[model samples]
Target: MKTIRLFSVLLFALSLSSALSQAAKPATVSVNRIGDGPIITPELDQRMGGNIQGPSLIKVPKWIENPIGQYYLYFADHRGEYIRMAYA
Candidate 1:
């Protein structure tokens, strides 16, 4: 009984440490853009809007810090027809 209790405790401790280590790592995401050509600027892209074609997927590090303000980083995805947005 004592040996079983000690093993259980050790197993729990190991699991907790593993979880903590994984949690400590920064989050990441994949960015996918479906377009033919790259837009030169945000303003131009907004004005012209989806003038390009083709599809691309990029994996990049996620932003860790969010500023203390009203503005926030919004994530989005869309098909040629519909759009979606999420607050981070």
Candidate 2:
């Protein structure tokens, strides 16, 4: 009876630990964009710390103005897009 109780306690502890670890994990945010071609702007580069590489996802708002020039692009959330640019 004592052995069974110990086993049960150990299993409970293990399960609790696993649940906590999973909860502590951070969530990854993905961005999606509508339309083709490149979406590069000074604002995006600034927001990304001037480094646009790897897998990036962003939610673009409608009527976005260019950070460098007077231009606008339609953007929305939950859209996947690719941005390849270099900062100098």
Candidate 3:
């Protein structure tokens, strides 16, 4: 009986926490249009250079402190040898 009562309280607490949680939505967005500069520039770094491929980017959330600009670009070498970053 005591075990069941504790389980019910825990279940109720979990449900209430889920109900209070909300999905995050960004307040501002920066879109790269079709004619905008190439997302991957081959000459970003000549030493570790290979044709820059598979670009991934993340826009900073307002609540987070980003020392860089509004968005960040991240990419890795094909063999996972190196991961590089850029800010914009």
Candidate 4:
């Protein structure tokens, strides 16, 4: 019936829109000042993670454009901790 056909089309469109909505990632990131001095210190290293035994310094560029959320910061310490901090 025409009603069933229209309902099927509506459902398809709704499903497509829902998928697209879920696919979009938000563009949000945390930032730290480049020369603010010790965003993370040896004392605070434990908060960041184990093995982050030094002063934190920002080594990333001030401006980064990641619309798709493909980019990540990874660490603020010398150690390979799973941290993320952008510099601005």
Sequence-dependent TM-score of model 2: 0.28
Return the TM-score for each candidate structure: 0.29, 0.28, 0.52, 0.28
Clashes of 4: 0
Candidate 4 lDDT, 10-78, residue by residue in tens: 999999999998896888989756686744444644566545543344444446555334333334444
Arranged by lDDT, best first: 3, 4, 2, 1
Over 1-88, each residue of candidate 1 has an lDDT whose tens digit, in order, gives 9999999999999999999888866679666787977433234436325433333322234554553433333322233542322122
Q: Report the C-alpha lDDT of model 2 over 1-88, residue by residue, as the tens digit.
A: 9999999999999999999887856779675777885565446545444443343433344466544333334433223344343321
Error of 4 at 5 (Å): 0.3
Per-residue accuracy of model 3 over 7-74 as CA lDDT, tens digit each: 99999999988877864666895665787587676676675567565788787878886467898888
lDDT of 1 at 74: 33
TM-score of candidate 3 against the unseen true structure: 0.52
Candidate structures ordered by TM-score, highest first: 3, 1, 4, 2
| Comparing 1 and 2 on TM-score, the stronger one | 1
**lDDT to native, each model:** 0.49, 0.53, 0.77, 0.58
Q: Is candidate 2 or candidate 3 better by lDDT?
A: 3
lDDT of the structure predicted as candidate 1: 0.49
Q: Pick the candidate with the highest lDDT.
A: 3
Q: Which 10-residue span in candidate 1 carries the lowest summed lDDT?
A: 79-88
Instruction: Specify the highest-TM-score model's number.
Output: 3
RMSD of each: 13.5, 12.3, 5.6, 12.4
